[model samples]
Target: MKIIVIGATGRVGAQVVTKLASDKENEVFAGARTPENVPNASNVKAFKIDLHDTKDTILSELPDADALIFTAGSGGKDLLQVDLNGAVKVMIEAAKKGIDRFVMLSSRDSLTPDSFSGPNPSPLANYLIAKHFADLWLIKATNFDYTILQPTALTEKPGSGKVTLGSYSSNENSISNVAAVLAAIVQDDSTIGKIIEMSDGDMAVDDALKNLI
Candidate 1:
């Protein structure tokens, strides 16, 4: 699988890239603003994907990729630019290139955007507005086999391989754990068209994902 990881330089995105590249059968294209930071390995190559650039520019930089995994975000800086439009831009370009498989690293807030809906929702509105639209765009507009992983508040801990991969809720999830999920699902056709709400639990990662089918 030739996987293109957007926001490959960010916290979770970087980890996702590493995990994907660890598998010898998978060729990973780590797309980031700072491509130099991405390691130059035999299976992994750093490519340029600047969301700040025009949609055409971003599209042109993309290779003949098999799958495109979007883990990018603006981290509260430019939500519209990077988080919302940037993601949508990549999706459009990926479709233009005939890349069908896509996995998105979304937030749990996006699951209940109406409960936390509107431009500035209350209680659980951390990037809610942006995530809502971006996630919706993928579901409604694209033809890709998409799986959206919506995780709750994140923790800094290194989570276990076991996890609950369903309609479960918890305080926090490890970033690494989320990245692991991303890596697994991108290659999993069973995860297609599923909007999984994930959290930490006792089920093994592969087992948990398998149970979802």
Candidate 2:
């Protein structure tokens, strides 16, 4: 399988790239705004993909890929542009290019009122609003095989190699564990059309996702 991982320079995205590339059967391409910034790996190739680019340009840069894993973000800035608009644009291009599978890295509570944890107008609110719409667009506006992973606040701590899926009590997840789930789902057809909410837990990553609805 040929997969393109957007935001490959990011913490979670880099892990996804490395994990997928380690598989001999899968060809992974790391996509970033500045391709040079992506970590070097023998099995992974880096390419430039600006979400804000023209549709044609974006499509041209993206090879004929079997799936697209989007973990891009603007780091609390340009939520509307990079988070919402950029994501929608990539979805559209994926449709045009016949890329069937899409895996979105979203946040927990993005679709619920609880997303706005703070006051009415907070940065977290804006971020959740952007992700909410992006996830909605993927579900309602496209026919692609899509899996949305809504994990809580990400941490750099070593993964427990375990996770809780579907629901969780807190909004905290290790980046490695989240990446493990993403790598698992990228090749698991059963996960198609599923929206999974995740956090650190005692269940192994594969076992947790196997029970997804």
Candidate 3:
């Protein structure tokens, strides 16, 4: 499988690239503004892509890609431009190019009911809102096989290689575990058109995903 990973320089994105590239059967194109900075791997190829770039420019850079994983964010700046518009634009281009699968890294808060209406709403509400719209666009507007992973607050701790799908209470997930999930789901047909909420738990990543409804 040939996969394009946008925002490959970010924390979780970098891990996703590493996990996927380690598989001998997969070819990974790590897309970042500074392609030179992406991790070095035999199966990983770094490519330049600015989320803020024009649609045509971004489309031209993606070639022969079978799947796309979107993990890009503007880090609290320009939420509308980069998080919402930029994400949707890439989805549009990928659909145009006939990419079959698209996996989006989203936040749990974006879908939770009380996160937006409570007296003390999430400080990152704006960012979550952007993700909500972008996720909606992928579900309603695009034709690709899409899976949205909505993980709770992310931590950088080493992965336990164990996770829970659909729901969890701790509301915390390791970046490594998230990467493991991304790598696993890309090759699994059961995840198509499914929106899963994830967090660290006892079930193995593969088993958790296989049990998804």
TM-score on alpha carbons, each prediction:
0.94, 0.94, 0.96
133-191: candidate 2 lDDT, tens digit per residue:
99999999999899999998999899889899998956689999998899888899998
- The lDDT of model 1 is 0.88
**Deviation in Å, model 2, residue 140 alpha carbon:** 0.6
Q: Which residue runs of candidate 3 sit more than 4 Å off their true CA positions?
A: 112-114
Write model 3 residue lDDT over 1-213, tens digit each, in one string: 999999999988999999998988999999999999998899999999997889999889876789999988888888999899999989988888999899999989676647766798788888888998899899999888999999988998889999999887567899999999988888888999989899999999988987887
Query: How much is the lDDT of residue 4 in candidate 3?
Result: 92
Candidate 1: pairs in clash: 113-117
Tell me how far candidate 1 lies from the true structure as C-alpha RMSD in angstroms.
1.8
Best by TM-score: 3
Which candidate gets the maximum lDDT versus the true structure? 3
Candidate 3: lDDT of 109? Answer: 67
Any runs in candidate 1 off by more than 4 Å, and if so which?
A: 118-120, 123-126
Instruction: Provide the lDDT at 213 for model 1.
Output: 53
